[model samples]
Target chain A: MMAADEQQLILRVKEGDHEAYRVLVGRHMKHAYNIAYGFLIDHDDAEDIAQESFVRIYESIQSFRGEASFNTWLYRIVTNLSLNKLRQRKNTNHRITNLPHQSAMNIISPPDDTSYQDVKPIIERALHALPTLQRAVVILRHLNGLSTKQVSEILRCSEGTIKTHLHRGMKKMKTQLTEIKDEVI
Target chain B: MSAHKQIQSQFYDYIQGGLKSDEHSIIDTHLASCTMCRCKLEELKRFIESPVFSPELPSDKLPPEYWNNFALEVEQKIRTYEIEKREYSLSLWDWLNSLFIFHKRQIIAVSSALTIVCMAITGWLLYVPTLVDEKIALPEISSSQFMEIDQKVGEYLHKSKTLLVGISNLDLEEKSPIDVTAEKKASRNLVQEARYLKNQPLDIRSARLIGDLERIQIELATIKDDAAIPRIEMLREGIHRGNLLFKIRMAESMYEMPRLMNVNNIYSGDRK
Candidate 1:
């Protein structure tokens, strides 16, 4: 949450006070990095995304009417930029991973002893399997625990679209994981 | 619609829990009696909870080093962007200064030349009206100077007669001491002058004289070397038949004598 005083700092930044911008960035840098990291799951990429998002925010701050607080606007920027980078990465290397043929097929069962580490690859595969919008919605709603309404706001999509993506994403993961769980049992 | 497809389609909306009361109750009653939809709703919960299935957003903090210079780095990027944006904009004064510095010698030379040309044009504009006024005043003053004009015309006619008499006496067939080529060229020039003089608004007798002079000059211009004897004989016969030489002498006397007598009378009256 942005402090009430942060709005004053935003005003100063709009007035060309660099120190005010620095303070605003200092306050929100951690939150921005976490959101980007949650999406990209990379430390260096997250940091880069955070920095770029701040630069974009600074450049377009004059047009920032405060209806959606500076944070949601910043979230939208970092999330959108990270999503683009993910799409570019997806396009470059479109091949599936080197799991066993059976695991790759559908079951996605963790090899022998099931642990979070063993399951991590399966979860990541399922998450990336989703279409880009669905993946964003799932990450924002399920992973980040944002409400469907908040996810819709971040994605600038209708609540119905967000809900549809969220439900479909979860359902696919459930079907896969249930099959794996049936194998483990 | 199949019962299964209807349940599957509304599964997303139903899971998000925003369905209206009537719609919710309808789906709820169907789910209560329908084993497949009930099982599907149960699967939705189990999947959201499973570690093997759910996406982890990795909210763990990044390393301390990552945040250390983070704000400074962003501000530096912002400052650099601002610098680049400013460097790209050239104000009018800066543009003019650059232009002046780039072509200093050419600009100075062109400006100096233009200044001199402008001064010349201004002088011409001012001086030209005076020249015009003088020209206008001149024709009016020279309006009463017709006696002088008539005398000048008489003198011009007297000069033209000398050229005419020379050509008529030069019997080209005999080809004597007269330089015939030079005399022919002179006569050609005299023809051009006579043509100009013929157009002058003058007494009918003078116009007729000029007209006769031009025709003789043209016949002289076309004189064939082999046919020279016959052409010259022909031309002289034509002139004698017209009695043009006698008419010219008589008109010159009549025109010049009156102007001279008038001037003499004026001088005499002034003396008395």
Candidate 2:
């Protein structure tokens, strides 16, 4: 029954129902952006990948049988595109810049709370310090709040592998935070 | 220190409720009894549940307006892409139409002659095959032969299913406990049978199944005891993507005995 509704939405999108497409995009846009952002660590690049992912979805919605859920399909696209962007960056010999520290400080509220601003960059730095797979596991499992099973499905690994990556990633992040805290104190 | 090490290794999984029931209970009992471990768990919790970690957005949410424009921007880009594609196709047609404008009659005449020549060649090719087909007679196999072939094919399908199930059910987390020698030998045996069966005059579906089966059997036959996790995962993915086990079962039940006995159609290579 859920599948029937999903198919109906897809069919409406295929039929050029603009409102239906909008609804579909609205439902997943934040997640798609955040997941991409988690990978790219740059807002503009994340937004580009997210929009491109949706466009690709719209173009190919005709071929999408309800085999995987729409969320899975969208995430797979987002993940692949983000990975491609990373690969392209590597091939071009460009260093992956750290998260935009000043930009982060500007957006985190309440703007007067200096401590919150200081800690945000530390968290972002610790997140970026982990290896790519571990970071991806962290973002998807913790930040995105996807279940371990869903993360495994999206990442195409066994659930055991996902759990291991999550465990390692969290441990590393905690270590980084503590080390930094001790240094500051 | 040793005891704490064992329990502490599980602290993250414990906090996440990712432990199995027995493990969870073990952690629970230990935490209740050990004040030091309880403090450790509290510290871990405070660290994880810190406000820095719980923000809905990883960094910060963009102003609401940025999100409001996001969907519209995607739709507009799609429209632009569609328009560009249509215009590109239109330009290609215009180019072709322009090329044909000058020598229209000559082009038409040449095209007509080419079509007629192609048709004559195709008709001759189609006619020549029938003449050769009329002289060839397909030898009839007796019922006994059909039954023997069916039995062999059925056994092959069942064995293939068993092998795949074993590989699929392997507990990957266990440290290399696979009976690789036994699996490799079974695959080798299947490969030998598959090669012999591929030459049989079977229906198209059965033949295709044999072909796919042979490919995977060869993959299995090559697996070493020290095969890497990625290699094992690749094999698993191949089986899953092809849906091979289910197809083998279907061929076993539906195509083996009764379908093989329909000798005339089977001999003619009829496809379902």
Candidate 3:
């Protein structure tokens, strides 16, 4: 979204324009949900956090300084809140164990012209096993197609740290996929 | 550079698509010359370029209902925020009107009293110095003349006191036992008083008095043959140091009061 348009929408939302806020949420909901899902690895929790993040954004829209891009700032908030939820879940020993598993044959098999359902579970599991920072780096780099510098700014880290995480994360994914090959097949 | 280092550097550049023509030429030459580096580079390239599957776009699988539901939820949240903002603004307006109706008379009375106090203070500041001068005439001394006279008087007093002590060295300690004892007792009393004052809030008046008593105690100890001299000197030095520190603290306190007062004044002015 053009920054000028987003700023205009934010101003309207602050002035109690529901339509303007709706437009903003409609534009950003998928991105926000994807980011939350990348961290929490559960659809329901991701959806809840994504919704909560929008509500928070609405509440604090007045305080948004235009120094950083609105999308970048929103991503930061969503990712941090998702990570906090993950930490809380871990502390409570609420293991998220409902992820649907599929056999290797089922994943690699042609299924009525559907390619996504077969691979999504494995990919999600691989992404969930990554360290938090590494997962964020991978999602930002591959899924969002953000530059390394942009990822560093959103994560509030140095570019060197982003590069290190990306390299280590990719290597780890390669190793994990090799280990999972037998089970999947 | 070592083959590994050269290859690693090139790999990052190649992955980022930032290799210049010259660097590309170098890499090509290396690839032709070194089989091991070339093989490693090929593996890295293949890994980077390989496609990994991901979830397909939801818009393709799901009907328009999915997006409509999401849009409706967003619209509902926005409406809630709008209602909250409207209610807040209305409450704020009601609060301001109520304040004006309830406190108008009190505010006027306070303002009048404040104006009268300010005028009285201004008049007093203008006239008090003249009134004091008229009531009590005082002598004036130039700075240079005062210093010269003080130095002369101090020298004369010091010489006379030394000469008198020397002449009275005839069992002086025994002849004036009462006076000596009174002086010793007074010194001990001053020390105790200083210790007590040290424990209290260190203000300018207390600190000054403590400094003066400590200086006198130090001088007397230097001239006397009492065992308490060393102990008294230590105490005296401690009190003097404490007074110096207290002086800094007193200045900071004085400065801070004005700062706080200025802030309060600004806030009150804004309220008015």
Which candidate number has the best TM-score? 2
Give candidate 3's TM-score: 0.56
**Candidate achieving higher DockQ, 1 or 3:** 1
TM-score comparison, 2 vs 3, better candidate? 2
* i-RMSD of model 1 (Å, 1 decimal): 7.2
Model 2 misses residue B106 by how many Å? Answer: 11
Per-residue C-alpha lDDT of model 3 across residues A5-113, encoded as one tens digit per residue = 8899988988988789888888888888777766775666766787888888877888987788878878888888998998999899976564543343243334674
When candidate 2 is compared with the true two-chain complex, its DockQ is 0.23
Best by lDDT: 2
Candidate 2 per-residue lDDT over residues A5-85, each given as its tens digit: 667888899888978888889888999999998877777788899999999999999898777789888998998899899
lDDT of 3 by residue, B145-214 (tens): 6454434333322322222232233233343322233334334444555555455344466356455654
Model 1, B1-272: lDDT tens digits are 47765665566557667578897888889988999888888777565555554544343323456566899999888888888788767465688788799999988999999999999999999999999999667545354465655665565456456656655786564554333454455557667767766654567888888788778878877776666667766877877788877877887886673433332221122311
Evaluate chain B of model 3: give its TM-score.
Answer: 0.29
At residue B165, what lDDT does model 1 achieve?
A: 68
Show model 3 residue runs off by greater than 4 Å: A101-114, B1-44, B53-62, B80-272
User: What shift in Å separates residue B141 of candidate 3 from its native position after superposition?
Assistant: 15
How many clashes does the backbone of model 2 have?
0
